[model samples]
Target: MLPVDTTQLLKGVLDLAVLAVLRDEDGYGYDILRRLRTSGLTEVGDASVYGTLRRLFNAGLLSTYVVPSVEGPHRKYYALNAAGRGELQRSGKIWQDFASTMDDLLRERETA
Candidate 1:
């Protein structure tokens, strides 16, 4: 299969992705980045994740706190607030619907 431009696709879904990660547990910037990679989003970058965290926090969808770290400076952890959780649920549903439709179309094309 041809490679897809995941970066372009990720632009619109970054919020949902970040919120989804925070939905389960809080994480610092690097920790969140690692989680994205672990979740199969290998093309995701550190800068993009950091920016999304800032935007989500500014939009009041996420909350943040600092925890002291022995390895280095204090870590800023992010968690999904009620608003973030709501957005995650709504966006996940929309994505699921869109993906299902795309899958149906692809199947029809293959059969034709």
Candidate 2:
């Protein structure tokens, strides 16, 4: 299949993506980056993930804490707060509805 230009698409959904990941568990910067990649967001960048984390924290959607590491400096872990959870729910529903519409459109095109 042709490669999709996910940059624009991702820009709109990065907040939802990052929040969704943290919903399950808290993670440090690099850990969150890895999770995003492992979960098939291969084009996601580290800077984008870090920036999203900071933005979400500042927006009161995320809570953060620092944990000391033996191998390096302390790591800051991020977790979802009540506001974040609510945002996630809202965004997820919007995404699902939009995706369903897109699927319907694509199927129509295919059948035309």
Candidate 3:
């Protein structure tokens, strides 16, 4: 059996993962990337996360604001808007259903 390419898998679900991370708190690009890595998605890359954030913002699913930082440059934090929250809910349900189906199939194979 071939090993799964998790980076490819992460590409498919990066939007969902980013939205999930922003569900609780708004964060800047690097902070969001860090949260994802800390949550065990260490394979997620900085560029991927930044691109995802930009896409989400452009799609009207996210809002951004700049916060001044004394230590460095201003940070643009991304937050989930109403549409983003709705999308998170809708996509989250779809993901749950798909995951359940996959789990069931794998379990059946194990039993067989």
Q: Cα deviation in Å at residue 90, candidate 2?
A: 0.3
| Alpha-carbon deviation at 15 in model 1, angstroms | 1.1
Ranking by TM-score: 3, 2, 1
- Better structure of 1 and 3 per TM-score: 3
Off by over 4 Å in 2: 1-3
Which 10-residue window of candidate 3 scores lowest in summed lDDT? 45-54
Using lDDT as the measure, what is the rank order of every candidate, best first? Answer: 3, 2, 1
Q: Over all chains combined, what TM-score does candidate 2 have?
A: 0.95
Write down the lDDT that model 3 would get: 0.97
Report every candidate's CA lDDT. 0.92, 0.94, 0.97
Error of 2 at 104 (Å): 0.4
* Candidate number with greatest lDDT: 3
Regarding TM-score, does 1 or 2 come out ahead?
Answer: 2
| Residue range 37-104, candidate 2, lDDT tens digits | 89988899889999999999999999999999899899999999999999999999999999999999
Alpha-carbon shift of residue 9 in model 2 (angstroms): 1.2
C-alpha lDDT of residue 71 in model 3: 100
